[model samples]
Target: MTTCPLCGFEFDGTALSCHASCAFNERCAVICCPNCGYQMVDEQRSVVADRLRRWLARRNPPVREIGEVCALTELRPGQTGRVIEIDAENPVRSERLQVLGFVKDAEVYLLQTKPTYIVRVGFTEVSVEQSIGAGIKVLVG
Candidate 1:
């Protein structure tokens, strides 16, 4: 779980938003200061940097990479396949993909990959260059 850098309040690791009434919702994840009721977003670059460092550290653990199901539309061009493993770290990308209603545990397939790899998910085909990351459970048949 991540702590509110501004208020020192602890929250769930997967939580992105603090609350609806938070003032910093426009800029960052809303985190309210319980003492002053000051609604703010944690914009500390160090926090992000630290998180990245941690991710890099855990990446080599050899966990069940791509063991969870995922959708085809979630894959994008020019992104590293390893991205899916760190979905929470990439909120912008996650949000973009989530808009399409594709989440973990969806089925997809790799079609072609020369100039760009095409992925077949559901009823559509998407071409991307980035590595789709691990932790996705896919069935090949």
Candidate 2:
């Protein structure tokens, strides 16, 4: 079984076998989500990868604290919080942000608000426009 990275739709990996009719199917590494048409690289399964994922999940469980939910833009620079939701008007834009590490339950650090909104999601610092930052809601204690 494979889960769509964007929509969280779980389906048999063979569903992607529809590319059997395509000439480049054998060499193509891209996989598309049937539900939302999101494309991503088809990485092979690895036991080490699975173990690391489990370990990381155990290390950082979901945050359940009762906290204020507000837009990422509302956070003061230097404040840290967990993402609650992204309310972008365009679904594709929301999914793109999710792919860039602003997904629910992930920790985010508001680095700065001036110039462009600079935020740290995991180890990557993402530069988001003010308009887009306003759509990402986070839970701040």
Candidate 3:
């Protein structure tokens, strides 16, 4: 199933109709939204490329040891762990977390969970939305 990048509707990728006036529909790799008429380049190939790049980029994180992996929200106050992954679908959003020292291999401590998630990464305490917390996976020792 392909999701409409605009309206967040899930539908078959083969069902999208491209209304754009591009001259190369035969070679074009784009998906159009059926509901809102939004068009986006199909990123399946790019995702594969990204996966290959990540595989070659860095040494495996220290969090690779066998253990149960859970989202940041599952951590209680005073709990600590190493960030193993962030499940964000957008590169910009993932980079934003990286800027805040929430990247893989970073140590984090859960400071609070009420109203929102407050976690300490490095020397900074960051307030994060509950939904965003769900995207951050941590490896607890």
Identify the candidate with maximal lDDT.
Answer: 2
TM-score, per-candidate, Cα-based: 0.32, 0.52, 0.52
Candidate 2 lowest-lDDT run of ten? 57-66
The lDDT-based order of candidates, best leading, equals 2, 3, 1
Error of 1 at 52 (Å): 38
State the lDDT of candidate 3 residue by residue for 1-141, as single tens digits. Answer: 988766898878765555568676555567777777777766653465567668855422233233568888777777788899999989999999999999889999989877788999999999999888889999875
Residue 76 displacement (Å), model 2: 0.7
Can you write out model 2's per-residue Cα lDDT over 15-119, one digit (the tens) per residue? Answer: 566366667666665677888878766655445556778897865435444487878877777778899888899999988998999998999998987777899
**Superior by TM-score: candidate 1 or candidate 2:** 2
Cα error, candidate 1, residue 100 (Å): 3.5
What's the distance in Å from true for residue 98, model 3? Answer: 0.2
Global lDDT of each candidate: 0.47, 0.80, 0.79
For residues 39-64, could you state the per-residue lDDT of candidate 1 as single tens digits?
Answer: 55454534675687789776433222
